[model samples]
Target: MSSAKLSRRRVVGAGLGALSSAVAGVSAGCTARSGPPRRLLLATGPEGGPYNAFGAALARAVAASGSRLRIVPVSTAASVDNLRELDAGAVDLALAMADVAEDAALGREPFTRRAAATALARVYVNYTHLLVPADGPVRSLRDLAGRPVAAGAAGSGVQVVAGRVLREAGLGEGPSPARERQLGLAESARALREGAVDALFWSGGVPTPALSTLSREVPLRFLPLDGYVGPLRERYGPVYTAVTLPSGAYGLAEPVGTLGVANYLLARGEVPEAAARELLTVVFDRWSDLLREVTAGARLEPRFAISTGRVPLHPGAVAYYRSVYG
Candidate 1:
């Protein structure tokens, strides 16, 4: 911590006392061992994605906070790939799904190596949206029992959550015999428009750019998944929560209630404490302005961001949480 600047005390004894105090104060101000400013890499997702916008906002906020930290926006898939970047030292910070972060940190599923990363905080929930044709009858997960569904690409977090949701609804293990297609978000949107697929699963923030762009031309229907909330919460630990996407978020008819998982900010265990403190401070202090930059990032709050599941919080983040919120 930097020492507070002190004014010279009243000189009662001799002129020597006042001179000594002034010299000491000046020396303290000049020689205080402040840590060097750092440049950090912030790994987000593809262009027009929530992570991309949020990352840019964070960068601006940090710069405005008088912190000598730079947030370099790196494009990533934000699933297992983000964890790999942190492990390989290609990036210092990343926006990652809580469940995926947990698995990688614990060396569970996709992550063969237990990632040396820690959570900064949970930012917001990524609600799963099952988008279908507006005129279709697929109002719920069960309605797609035999229809063509485009699950997201393999190795993506969207696919992981979609698979889990399907399993919880007793539709996994290929039991439903539905026509399933594996494709990316863009491909799925095209497939849905072409009638090649009846439904598509997209797990992202409300008003996702891709979904919004699709809504501009196609009449998209958001399928609700409330029935699986209880079962999903019970099975997936506390990561799954009931969330609602407001009406008109994507020019929809009404709000869509569904289950979702929180997204978290993560960093390698070796990030400097001072750097973390300043970075988090920037995020919280300039939150409102940052939200203006990334419309969806308005959900970021210091109180809500700290909601980590089982993953351990980084020591630096812990200090910030204590100093400001304890």
Candidate 2:
């Protein structure tokens, strides 16, 4: 086998071995308690997005695992909305972009006060997508100046990154600033197809379903944003990374460079330790199942999951990881 395939198998095998040990430890130490299952509201992204799909799949997987915790997926505006809902005590768990979560933790722009949110795991990475028509006049970031662009839906992580990217490109607040529209992924794709907007921004898993379908209907192109990663990291810490959208996605003839941000599963500081631990137990045990609904090449390995950067991990997650690594 090729070295790449062999390396992937080694990683997967090691992760699964660690997960098996963790599960065995849990089973041997815990005793059955007779009671109603604990229900948790997981605030996910809008319909058709990776967050929403993964949330639903996770709920099913947890249920199938026979765990006492029952996760209910609640669709929201994604990242920022998920964080706000988590802070408001409206949800027990949420999925958010690391950058937006950091802003909430630090009480940065768009957040009035610091939030008491804790990370369960760094689940996946989202690629920044700057999409335009294959035959449109928007050949570069400069071409977007003074043009209408769907930035992202209000209270979404995409909006936070899109604004920063545009500002860095000098199209945010200049003589010819790009007109911004607050449209969700579905709406933005439709708007682009109908020529209502010149370009749209999205941050989601590779080959986002909406964009993939839109690409089939109307030829689309992804503008490279790799150049902005360095500047963004220099200004906003290390939340952004340079990544590439592999060729063939959206029917691209060649790979397109872009910025990537990690996505995290977060919980309110008040969630019970037992419940938190149980939820993550199932998460790690059923990691492969969760990946089916996430992005291509996604992994739920404990090493990767624990790297939440500045966002503090929940105490329960800390305990769980200790058990896995110990």
Candidate 3:
């Protein structure tokens, strides 16, 4: 309760202490003194996705800590949408792809304006999945140029990453234009099965439930992305990593070299450092529990978590890390 941000929304979860709060002006901005934050909203990805699952589990862990702070997990389009939520003051914290945060901070293409956000910490690396049917003609990302492809839901981090990968692959303005469909994770899988899309791009943790289910129902294969990693990293900063998607993931037979992007936890830059610190404390303390429930959280290492690229780390997050690591 010592470091919880208060908002008008429903509580995200209870904090460690059963403290209460009294904000001088919640709508204008919270100025609470000596009480648990009434509520907090955490912006996460779509339902049934890794982001949402992990967010829900995090809410549960915070509530179980007995802090009396109520944290509500919000499911959205993910990344870009989460940043928007934070900008609109609809959420207290959010999970975002580092590249998206970098773009948002810079007010680059896609984002019309700069957002008042800063990195709480780096979290995980989402492996980019360029999947096609095992028996289909779309053997690689280049092969799907003329075909209908579900790049990702409109404005989602998935689509953003996909667009970058396509550009780096020299398919940005190729002759055979890809009919990119705006589809969510589940919808993309169903559309692929229904012959609506020849290939689909996804950016998430390994063993994403929807992909696993899609693999079981249909013979699907992921195109290797390692070839573009070097170029992507060179162009898009160090956020892009060349990593091999382990074999047996989503039932693949052997490892496939692919590009991975770092994911981040962010909060409004206006949020008090102490509140940010509390959020970090809860996360670090209960991180193991989150990992046990969803291995996607296993990447929440202190060292990597602090590697927030272009997005500067929050002061509170900095303090928390020093207290623990030092």
lDDT of 3 by residue, 183-216 (tens): 9988999999999889889988776777888889
Task: Tell me which residue pairs clash in candidate 1.
Answer: none
Question: Model 2: per-residue lDDT, tens digit, 114-161?
Answer: 987999999889999999998988899879999999999998999999
Better of 1 and 3 by lDDT: 3
lDDT of each: 0.72, 0.84, 0.76
Name model 3 segments beyond 4 Å from true.
Answer: 1-34, 292-297
lDDT of 1 at 310: 74
Q: Report the error of model 3 at residue 168, Å.
A: 2.2
In candidate 1, which residue ranges exceed 4 Å CA deviation?
1-37, 178-180, 293-297
Minimal lDDT window, size 10, model 3: 15-24
Best by lDDT: 2
TM-score of 2: 0.89
Per-residue alpha-carbon lDDT of candidate 1 for residues 225-278, written as tens digits (9 for 90 to 100): 877788867766777888888887999778988878788889888888877887
Q: Is candidate 1 or candidate 2 better by TM-score?
A: 2
Query: How many residue pairs clash per model?
Result: 0, 0, 20
Among residues 3 or more apart in sequence or in different chains, the pairs in candidate 2 whose N, CA or C atoms overlap within 3 Å are none
